[model samples]
Target: MSQTLDMFATDDYPALTAGVDEVGRGPLCGDVVAAAVILDPNRPIMGLNDSKKLTEKRRERLFDEIQQNALAFCIARASVAEIDELNILHASMLAMSRAVDGLQRAGESVKPEFVLVDGNRLPKWHYPSEAVVKGDSKVPAIAAASILAKVCRDREMCELDKKYPGYGLAGHKGYPTKVHLEALKTLGVTDIHRRSYGPVKALL
Candidate 1:
């Protein structure tokens, strides 16, 4: 199967810049997570695909490698309350913006000439950006960003799981799985749950 995504590979752009991605946009609870990664084009990591395609263990391993090897990177998030107020789409864009902002604050030399973001929707940022479909699978930096965002969101869900035991957040990571929906039905919605989401809102 041809897994390559043409969006990132076809364009002969400037020097390899930063890639950004986010997770937890569809979750019933927790904040939107975003990561910005600037990779060394000369020393690219092998087997860099979408984080969703890799096992949790493999993704975790790659997470460390990406961190150690990346030229510059940053992970950022927008809270659940912020999502509720701005809506998930805008909140995710905001998180992506923050991640870029953080990278700029870290150092001027590390700033990106262009930002490659995963997914088709363009982020509402002033920076020069491109939105690529299936970018995480095609672009190494985007894939690294996906892994970082996923792991960070998973860690947050695990913490939430401890505070709210019955929800099984650690298992589903706030996704609307059958068990998660059942938990909502049985235990009622928690403060962390997104009241605007259809599945959780129906119960409310």
Candidate 2:
């Protein structure tokens, strides 16, 4: 017998429950961005899926849709300095916590009663929460959050690309791609490059 996973387990949660996700965890540069989204059950969004599985244009479109339709959403990030200081995993948790805090602040009247995080780990926080592996693909709210975080970080990378000019931050979004590695070897590590990471650490 095939075992089927329940994708909508969090649907029974309180109305104010939020979905949380982070982006840029695998990137060798740029801040890790996280988003918390409290979706309005009355307003369901279409075409929500993992940000990586969607085309850039599709993700952008859904990003706008999520911003306009979600009951509340907040984007937050841990900067390069924070990443270097605390390490990427803890920094990512810091970013996720900030995102949840921001969402609560933005929607002051209606705080989240619960939280569903995308990855297998949960940030140390007071909210009742559960971590769902690959939640972005299975949970609509997580999918929305993923798109928001991804788009926000990608835009920042584009700006960094303009400033840096050679690292292909815009194309690879600071990921340790072939072009990015070549550029790093040629131009050296920049301020935004995560010094704790192996490739960038080697260069330094």
Candidate 3:
């Protein structure tokens, strides 16, 4: 008989819980960023919500607060090359895994007794974790992870916009928006683009 894997084996909240989330999966460019946050129950930061639902000002504020208050937090990413080579979904998993691993090595690392990952898929890892639908909004730690990953990715895209101005990366953050597509058509694909993506591959 084959063994069964129970994703919710660790559903009960533990004293040390790490929430994992990824950002940039929908973008045609930029690395997929992931964050693992082990929030300190005693240092809770209110107003936690899915990063998308939060205003820019609120996200920025929470970003700092999460870093300051989390028992351990790590932001990790799979680069454009990794995304192109492994494909976005696998790359996202890799980034998520890396984030959790980083937390184990964090300056104040607290090995999580359980993990809650945002979205419907959980990365294959040794840690006991569950995949939660819309967990970013439902779980405080996941919300904090989303905020950190989003803010970090947004800032990186803004910096890249300075290097490659025509894509409006700062505004669209590398998503395949009309402006970004138009810019890609006129400017041609840059090195930062994921060559494996259909839109980018067509251009090449």
Best by lDDT: 2
Which one wins by TM-score: 1 or 3?
Answer: 3
> What is the descending lDDT order?
2, 3, 1
Best by TM-score: 2
Q: Tens digit of lDDT per residue, candidate 2, span 1-204? A: 001223566657888889999998899999999999998878888788888988999989989989988999999999999999999999999999999988843447346889999989999999999998888888888888999999999999999999999998889998889999999999998888999999999999
**Off by more than 4 A, model 3:** 1-11, 104-108
How many residue pairs clash per model?
0, 0, 0
- Which ranges in model 2 have alpha carbons more than 4 Å from their true place? 1-6, 104-110
What local distance difference test score does each model get? 0.85, 0.89, 0.88
List TM-score per model, in order: 0.90, 0.94, 0.92
List ranges where model 1 is wrong by over 4 Å: 1-7, 104-109
Q: Measure candidate 2: CA RMSD.
A: 3.1
lDDT of 2: 0.89
Residue 186, candidate 2: how far off, in angstroms?
0.9
